[model samples]
Target: MTNTLTDETSVVLANDPHWWRQATVYQIYPRSFADANGDGIGDLVGITSRIPYLAELGVDAVWLSPFYPSALADGGYDVDDYRDVDPKLGTLADFDVMIAALHASGIRLIVDIVPNHSSNRHVWFQEALASPRGSAARDRYIFRDGEVPDGTEPPSDWQAMFGGSAWEPVDDGQFYLHLFAPEQPDFNWANREVRDDFLTTLRFWADRGVDGFRVDVAHALAKDLTYPLRSHAELEEMKLVTDGSHPLWDREELDEIYAEWRAVFDEYDPPRIAVAEAWVEPSRRHRYAAPTSLGQAFNFDLLLANFDAGEFRAIIDHNIQSVSTTGSSNTWVFSNHDVVRHPTRYGLPDDPNRENAISKRWLLHGGPASQLDAERGLRRARAATLLMLALPGSAYLYQGEELGLPEVADIPDADRQDPTFFRSPGVDVGRDGCRVPLPWTATGSSFGFGAAGAHLPQPAGWGSFSVETEDADASSTLNLYRRALWLRRDLQDAEELTWHAHPSGSDKVLWFERPGGWHSVTNFGDAPVELPDGEVLVTSAPLIGGALPAAATAWLRRQAR
Candidate 1:
């Protein structure tokens, strides 16, 4: 629920102030993108080797997930060293080569920067542990003496976002706070040393030629020192609290912290871009996107939305108006490394009222495999993507999205690595399914993902979805993406959408126009709908009898009347 500009940011103008307004950025999970030197892992060399492929994918920029030195406790987010590249990922020289390659291809790069917490293996954390209580080292992090009277219970009852208690007690009568995994401890943002060090980290990367940064957990960094223990029911309400004074999320102090970071970003040429992955309430979103602060915040309402036309319309209208206040472009996204792939999520039976709502349980508690209609899900996914791409602001494409990949539902529990899976003690299978290594060829040990085996097992027959196979098929989802992205460039113009009445006069079908002759129509209903009088530019699926089919979308050019 982080309002992180995750749902926002696409293109950039490193030189032109408004490049991000209309760019199509691709997110690459290095762990799963491509593997070079095999070691059963993806690395910087692999990412660099694929620069030409990304150039061919029609993306305007690349948003890389963290590749810093880490224990992989929470993938790479539990960073141990902010200034250095992970030895497994590659060296600093490799990072420079990768950035150089991307720049040469006319693509911008936005590296992820994690400021909320640091891996316990980090020097600062270790130093804090070895130092005596109330020392300067411990002061940099959130360390407080436990509850009074021999200090048995925790200082507060704050539970970790993943699972279990948020307070990890040491031998002494003191406890440390970790909103996420125990391996990752939250920083004391109120401490000037902690704040100053982050400014150093930000400058370290910006000096490396990284165009911008995607701030991880952008909304969770600032916290109220008062550990107010609330009821369990109330604590579970929202990803980010918006009701009254919340101690853990979206605090008034966060804006000032971002403003400081914004000042550092401004030190760069043309000013570096930054998007907050803050998941705050819609009303509070503008604060994160304020021009003098982080500059952009992600609108995640669409990612959490069901595929209903009304839901999509409402989300679009809300986001467009929400970001308008801060003069930030609306951002749209469907899936990412954290969520279940959209194709699979959309495949669930449309009956939201069904007794079985999606939960952390396997299959997302989304009913039996037979109940998941894969065809319907893929169809809706294609249509939904077209709708997202046709919107005014920028859009993000997660790796394997173009291949129409679904959640790898049956990964062996023993092979799972996400902290949630371990923390949930197997109740929640975690995000490993969506983070599985990608298939790149029709046949190979790792589906051409790498010369060696992939760390995570690739599903059988997944080769059919490989880029190699899709490139040859005119009807493959990959080809559809290629064509759609190609055609979308001509359609991306207006800063807002002008809703057009559907010819079928049904609210289930949506029609909208951008300035130019470009227009888009989508049929979310069960029946086909007549398209406007325009030349068909591109469609998600084949038209049925010259009408847009159910669960489909189309782009067109207005014909001369």
Candidate 2:
């Protein structure tokens, strides 16, 4: 494979049967990507219009966050119809057209599948509400009689992932479980109809030319039948339990479900695939990524790592080892719709408990306290991007990361829409900051995101980081991404990564070499470091006196010894 970019077309490497292994995937949050109709919202047409930009970005595939028909509860994660597109997004016909456009541009399309739950407005859920407590319709969901005779209390005290009780009472007096929002009811995967429906849904999309599916909350589909009561202390500990011992999450039953889904995916000519959004422990992740189940599971350790070289190297090594056991590729990700942008996170002071602080109200405020030096953050983010791309597996890039977009932490409360925010009020800032609409132009009503209003507010200074601004600058983050991705094609089939030891034995810099003399060095310390003897190909920042600057990364082709 040779790195080549011609007329905005990426030409490199023959296709591998396991293309996802070492593939660069870009995630598009539909409503925030682009708006072609100027309807104050982004739609399928908005994405279709940007297919050229995506191909130009040099990504192998584009994974769309749920654009399915929904009540906008949980940002479309609460799906109402699995087979159709949301009218606000576009019709099913529009989705088909977009699929064709993406494939035409040498890109694969991956859509999100929220199998764990459905909108309360879904027909099955509505029927469950209308039917008697013990009726067949009610059986499709986790409906149980209330704890007391009056049925006033929920079946058991369980907390929703967003906030509040997991159980919602209906007029029929039976309580149903929803691990997320009340509008998003958890389905009874135990029901034969529920399991079969998901298989059909998989086929529906696979038949439409979608290359893959990003299964939302993939580990939460199957729950313990007993619905055991868990104490507050146990609940807190459950969040960190990766052993799958928790009653509700990472249950063994999920493996069977994925196997069935994989079977459906295998029916296709090229064979479709799925990636699990499972948050289970690293040791248990292989079950989800096994060849018989989902082909890949997102390795979020990188997302949770602090801006330290040692921490990142450890995470990378562990993820690669874990995924290898399953004969699957390690899926690396830095930022996604659910968390704060990596640039902002890297800028903030490192706290040992930062993971737990993600949902805290003070962190969500997105105030001065929530931010640090912006320039420093961008430098580290750029370096991180290079490090991620140089690794030997699939990398998921959130939409605006290429442009070095920061979190819009100051989104006004009234305009906030994440269920996590409303569920807890001012206590938790929610995920809206990272979900703000993207900017294409340096100046516009919504930074050219739409003709007029955008669903979420865009910060005033965001224009400076817009694509138009970065695209013109040769040294901009956007260009770095473009060049790195173009170069990445040559390393796609690389299966080994050997860490290079610094002569000074410093832990502040990460050095690694791949096959074909491709080496990457990233400096996470305060001082500059000497680069290995090689031809410098590209860098996250300019070299200072031939030394890799602090918070910078340099890719090189090793000189013959």
Candidate 3:
């Protein structure tokens, strides 16, 4: 629980400029993390109060989801004001105090920066709406004239990510573009004033002692400006294309913007850093972390991969190789606020379109998965966690994953708040299931999350996974995470990873060794496997008669030959 890093890790951190290359960061969804002042919403003070818990959790840094002034239209991704804190969350003074406390705990803070778009309520957006179509104010956003003289049709046929027309009509007969939700209007980054404003916003936080930022929608900032319509097939392929012709995403011009931001980052002491939430192809993903841009980007291939050894190994290898030339480190993530909790996903029966099925129907009424699937999911989730943590490079852990929390798939339709659900209406249930408030105590009005009701309902059975309940049991997922994190402190920042040959020569089992005599093995086959000749550091499940059980992972200190 001590804040001090081990001597070995400390030495590496002191000498290496890129300390984040192997750092373990914990992602916090602010509203769901903890609630203070009985307001039914989490705030800066709530986060400040939990620093001790985070320090004890053994994370090097905490990446908070957006807490800026917002309407909560897209879980705060629709930012209204970049320079100030939301009154509901707390004042800027509270944020300063929280930053100091986290630094005091030896944990860094990374705030979310939503640069691609601003809330419709943002002052700039308001001015743009009130101004003429060709006025200077309108130039700050992507406002354009309609295709027809009557202005009945949209300017283009681009579709929104949340399932609607990307363009929203205004009173002036012009339309503005918003790739996600209509509440969030995409900024015209080509405008000098918009660029200057964001730079000022960055400096504002850096001067306040905030460590870094996680740039939201980092790949979509720069648009091609041609306003071309894409075919349905082309739209589908855009998500995975590299050096693609897609006009709205992963455009080459984004690198210039990142370089400009990186220059601003270098002006401060210790040099602030950024991580991108980009969904570029494996070949081009590293550009966001090029030497002159943000230093790291989230690698979501691991999250999307099926629970198979070959798929995982292929993703790991491809990711590690992708960033090798950029001097940027690879980032691994399993579950996040946007995706279904991995436990629930892993427990479902495999389908050719498993990802799509899980995405659209995991939380729907009469969905495929059941309670029995949940038990199997938890087992695989535990094994996946150990395997992910044991891998090389940086890793990100979502807020409640340590408690083995499953997606609250049965949330009532009336209680759902995600914009995606509202936009699509019954087609996509959205992300509210994964964003439910955390349960800190075994019993409380809202499981100790708040004195009042939570914004999203916590399932009745969540008390079983509460911090208090898990902390009392050594075999609990919470303790497993603590033990793994503490043991991982000894792991060196080595780039080399060699896959070990399975004794049975089966593809279901995976074995790999790090350069410093650290080894990790996972069993996905139907039966248990004999442990290699090494001192077992940690195992996801209890070993049976000296053999590791199926759906289990073990980390070990390899014995000398």
Candidate 4:
């Protein structure tokens, strides 16, 4: 690498108002990140203690997954309070300290905000339960009268996004809509009271010094008042509707709601910002990231792509062009709290017999884990990281991927808590595997996650991927990330991408150049390829025989800016 990295390099772009556009944001799932209390779970104090580690990795921001009060029905997304922290996670005082610690480290904190639904334990939902039907207390949530003579059945055939029916029946013959678990009741955005409460929630966090927000289930906030009856297949097709006619998502009313959010965000001196976690179609996603709205949308097309050059190339080009119209940067993610880890996913065989591209199934026993090419998987994953970081948009890293940690994939059913697992009746194992506590030390009861055993089981080989081990080895994935992130600061000046020419016209090899002479070359094929002519800055793997090996990526610089 031509440039030497210093601590000051991380804060060079801190003055930019749209700092998130080309930033590296790391997602920390609080319950599994670190446990300062040693109670078999992670907490706010744990996250605050790790600020130096995050700063060393060079992430511009840290997106903390929900630490709010909850019964853990849906992995903390089932928020019980919008204004305070969960006692198990930490108290409000601890949260305030964590915010200060992150900011002092030059790392902005983006808290998770769940607007579409709230825990059934929330005061408003409990009030809806205590009050009679049609009362003002019941107006804040989506409660409707059941159809048919008996009123025992739900209002419609709608199903939950996790599993089972979306509508749950109450004792009074009234049914409330919950697009997710029954424990999380959907808010009726049409209600003035519901809208007003969320506005207050935004201001509350902003006042607490949160730099921004990562809005959860952003697309489902507004639903069709007239719940239409349709099969699951028909609902999937409706995602492509350009007119926002989907019964449960992407309604036209979302623009107005986000505009209100943006107004509150702009009230801050640096201007608080937000990124939407909407899974709408690519063409329709720009609306969520418009200047007047959240200002950024997660582009998950990379998560759907297999280990191939053509797929990655197409997705990169299409996403850049798609989001360019809005003048907002696209957010690229491969793994998150909700899905399988990318290394394990890339380890699977390339075939149609595998789970469908949309929703793949990973079993805890006798399933996809039985057949895994971990070596090739980690190789491809590292290569993918260079590709993602060198792109024209922002990049997001899941909690443990910096150490190249593979999916646990074998957590016992008895310890599982994901609603997806229980709701699906064990046919699907849910996300417990990927949520295992991080290994901080090579020798510990729970790999330094906590004094007690992790709430989710960790594998016997957990120590092999511990932070202590990775930190010692120069060739470790952790080093690759630390080095790559430092080099990535130079790539931020250019926002448009241009594909580089490959001497041999092979689709399996991808070579692209950004506007500032920063070129990234990736070889997804099973053969070594000659390196392009330039000074080698960084590479995913060591060069063999003066050529880039298979499943590796290299960043070459023709000249400095």
Candidate 5:
């Protein structure tokens, strides 16, 4: 018998009381964060060791990427066992220790929850595969025979995100659906049994004392009206599936599902935080994070906010306007395990200024190309870090980013772990670039990760961009990140500041004013720009320079009222 909440006493309509709103969440990709056992992988114990660092960095919470038992097909995104921790990342007891340690440091621990699908190797899927066609357990997955109908000849044109058909032929006479990799099978959320099993999984984690969850691809759970076999073969397999314009990403469908989850959260007081990973447009971002729905939906507007001042300004304006209208806590993300670092995205390469004597001299003398690139990259990296921490909404800092980690240089095809890279074979390398192990020390085969090789190779430039080197230097990118984060935490109005922004110049340079007489001037330009007269607060580059220094940014305190 379960202790289900009664409607009368449950108060299902209650709002979320979790302290996730406006709280900075630091996302930790477990496998690459730190390797403690010399087993070439980061473990729960390793993550536990970094909890105090997160606290010191002023992040209110930590969101651990999937550490559950898995075959590592999609880098742990494909979970074979939900209840147990993967041996590579440590045991269930190790997880408990990490959770307790994080909590002790006043940092909430949010685990990743992949409810939309499980690995094909999952026991449920394995059993379903072995069971008879008409079995109830088999019905928990979308199984269709032959081709289904659509407006066109081929079944409904639903293309998989990674390319090719969304349906994969299985042992049975039917095909199973997978929005992502073929190894990850989609679950039939419409099925009551499936829902019950998922709810059980949720409860299992809740009992283990997880503070919250970042639901992976939450909107991808629901499929479109079209039942597709395969789409056209040309240009990326062009599958004509419902792209959220139709009923696929509809609010009603998501709301109905979330209502059930909300009930689960209500059952446990100090309501567990639920942040959705739905990358819909900015206008629709709030639909999933409605007061009655998930607490927050990561806004990729920041991801799209690159170095262009115009684009960055529009992002801030859009967020401010949308949050005001929807009355929902705005969530801001600059970087994640899945995306490229901001500096790499924004910082443009420096072309030799033929007119400038120094640049001309360097080019004429055949100066090191890599050296020039490094100099340009370092300045841009510093600026992006400043801008990321100053943003008004609840921000997410990806692991290793604080140390100014750059994208992985070049790992061979066999070494690459991202399924997207494997499937596409260099067409799009996917997220493996950003998931390299953090560089802890400047020297050693493991960069002080452990006695053995790292789970993922440290970026070739790790020595120059390492935490150990930066921590000892005040002007380093790591120190800048630490200072900016501490400043965000120390500000008395940090919690109360209402985000307000105007067109500082072009949309590229965003000029935002916080409630407590603070001004954030961001120049996403490849060249420097002037700041409005006040006192120059903190800048990635010297304010004396006319140019903002290609992707330079700064936060200033507005003059006293």
Candidate 6:
């Protein structure tokens, strides 16, 4: 099979052997992107409308969050059917249009595959429940007898992500275990039928022309069959619940299943991608992303690593080293639909409260900080983006991240749709705070994301922080993102990422030298430090030393010597 490489060598490399490793992906939470049919919800058409925006963003692929048929129990995570699009989101024809538009824009599409579980309302589940006994349909799920038996308590003291036990008791003398919600019954991967069912779904989408998938909880698909639940005395309850106790994760059975899937992918003239949403430690995440396993798994090093200067540098360096160890391909993403927006997590400076000054800077361009403050934060974000693009692994962009979007602090409980919030609701769970509909128009209601009174709220003030407004303003963050993306694409060397640590007295700065002689420098903290003594190629930093004005990020390139 002599595959002809594209002018962009990386694209060819991505399309070859294992395409996902080298692919650049942009994630779109369909409900919040852009509503084209005035349904108060962003649908496939909405995503199709913004294909140009994504094309300009320079991403090789777009990862659409689940828009499948569902009961909306877990904000679509608990899928009812993998075969069709959710009516609220769009029709099957609409999805075909989206795929066509993306392909026209030179972008591939990867849909979310929630194989770990399904909505209780799913037909399969209904069938299983009706025939809980020795029925072929019952073989699809893990149906066991007795209360997940524990020593005078529930089995394994494992807590559900939403709170309570990971198991829910069923009336039929047997119980079904759900790692997430009672409504989401875990599929018994041990069953051949279950494995075949998922593989069939994979073929269904591939035949439909999807680029691939960002598999939901790939690691969670398998579990520890031992059924050994931890004792109640564990320090943190969550620790006992999620620490690799499932019966299906990383099981040899799973590895073999992947090998089968890999064979299927190989049959296609061009390889199909399968990126696992494995979000554990660096080492474990690697296991799922090995050559024969998932092509690429999500990287959490940039998101969950220590905030200390030395720690950050080591983390980045370690990630590069880790991928090298795999001798296969890999991917990286700092933020996604599942986590809080980076600016907020990166700790941007909050604005002083003012009665009349509520215009939406906080949600769109970030909070109302001073020019230095804004510049500092913007630079930090850019530096991060630069590092992401310059790394050996593929990078993922959550929607609105390029425009330096920050998390919204106040979404009403009624409007929240994330399953993470439904579980342990306190300081907000997962990333609903950052998952609001995108703002595409300055003067239109809901930023023109949808008709007024939509399911999701647009930022409080949409007249300013919108795509229409930012497109006209040269200095707008949206334009800056476009510039960076275009520059990356124009520079052939950008695809061949080459990185080296710069000489900084402190570990705060993570310096990278890209293929086209571009350098990116970053101080991950709120306090400013002196820039290294190199040609200040490009920097988003405001000042050399002082309070970094919070969320400040910058880029610098060394002059040709």
* Clash count for each candidate, listed in order shown: 12, 1, 0, 0, 12, 24
The local distance difference test score of model 5 is 0.69
- Report the C-alpha displacement of residue 151, candidate 1, in angstroms: 0.8
Candidate lDDT (C-alpha), each: 0.84, 0.86, 0.85, 0.86, 0.69, 0.66
| Consecutive 10-residue window with the lowest summed lDDT within model 6 | 353-362
Q: Determine the backbone clash count of candidate 4.
A: 0
Candidate 1 residue runs with Cα over 4 Å from true position? 1-14, 227-244, 351-362, 365-368, 559-561
Candidate 4 lDDT over 64-166, as tens digits, reads: 9999999999999898998989999999999888877777677888889999999999999999999999999898999988877878888777779789988
Candidate 6: which stretches are off by over 4 Å? Answer: 1-19, 148-156, 226-252, 306-308, 348-379, 425-430, 492-506, 523-561
Per residue, candidate 3 scores C-alpha lDDT tens digits across 1-561 of 122234443343343346677888999999888889788998889999989989888998899899999999999999989998999999998998888777767777789999999999999999998888699998999988888677778887778999899999999788999999999999999999999999989988887766689999898998876645665467776666676567888888887888889998888656788999987777777788886999888988878877888788888888877787888887888888898888887876654543643464534445655433887889999999899998878889999999999888778889999888888986888898889999999998789898897989998888999999999999999999999997887775476788988888888899999877899999988799987888998999999998999999999897656
RMSD of 5: 7.1
Say which prediction, candidate 5 or candidate 6, comes out ahead on TM-score: 5
Each prediction's TM-score against the native? 0.94, 0.95, 0.95, 0.95, 0.85, 0.83
The Cα error of candidate 3 at residue 21, in Å, is: 0.8
RMSD of each: 4.3, 3.7, 3.5, 4.3, 7.1, 6.3
Candidate 2 — which pairs collide?
A: 361-427
